[model samples]
Target: MKCIIGLGNPGKKYDRTRHNVGFMVIDELIQRHQWKLDKSKFKADYTIVQTENEKLMLVKPQTFMNLSGDAVRPLMDYYHIHLENILIIFDDLDLPIGKIRLRQKGGHGGHNGIRSIIEHVGSKDFKRVRIGIGRPDSSLSIIDYVLQTFPKRDTEEVMNSVNKAADACEAWVHKPFPEVMNEYNQ
Candidate 1:
């Protein structure tokens, strides 16, 4: 079994904010597969979808962004999923908007969501799909910036990246991380 986790704050107030790009990507995937993530447990809204060769648990953590691991750790344990079988999708302020990067393992790079997951999971060996949100202007505080919605002009671009991220995740179910990275990191 494989697990795909999307990190974001729960509630409608957070919808469409830059910080919720991870949730947006998961939404795209759910739509494409017609999978309903209606079940709630492990501090998350999740569902299990079967691919041709594997079962994937799609999780949207409800523990908010900073304390995401409160949800992920228990899900991992209950499902008997190893660190290597997990893929976390989240926003990245370090890269330009609309860009997506994949990595097999890495530090949190100052993301509170990733930090919590790392602390709870006890390893950084899982894969990550980072959807770029770009850093805000120097005058804008990071918190204010990420909590805001994307600019009107950038909305299309951001949504396109979300679709691409979902595609990359689907590819990941059948291919190795490196192969999926090479295909999607272009």
Candidate 2:
């Protein structure tokens, strides 16, 4: 079984904020495949979907961003999932808006959610799909910037990236991680 985890804060208040890009991508994938994410466990909302080749569990961590590992580690242990079988989707302020990047493994790079997951999992070798939210203006604090909602003018661009990130995820289900990275990391 493969697990795809989207990291973000839970609650309606964080919905559509830059920090919630991970949740947005997961929603896109669930909607596209007509899969329902109604199961609640391990501090997450998840659903299992079986394809001809694999059984996939799509998870949106409900423990919020900083404590995401609290949910992921337990879920993996219960499901007997290895680190390689996991892929995390989240937002990156370092990349420009509408851009996406895939990495086989790395440190959190200052992302609290990723840091938590790495700490709990004891490895930095899992795959990651980073959607760029872009940095805020110099005057704004990072915390406030990430929590801010995307402006109306940027909705189309953001959604386009979300769709592409969802597509990249689907491709990961069927192809090797390296191949998926090569295809989508343009």
What candidate 2 gets wrong by more than 4 Å, as runs, is: none
Q: What residue runs in model 1 are displaced by over 4 Å at the alpha carbon?
A: none
Best prediction by lDDT: 2
Worst 10 residues of 1 by lDDT: 25-34
Candidate 2 lDDT, 27-134, residue by residue in tens: 998998899998999899999899889999999999979999999999999999999999999999999899999999999999999999999999999999999999
Candidate 1's TM-score reads: 0.98
Worst 10 residues of 2 by lDDT: 29-38
lDDT for 90 in candidate 1 is 97
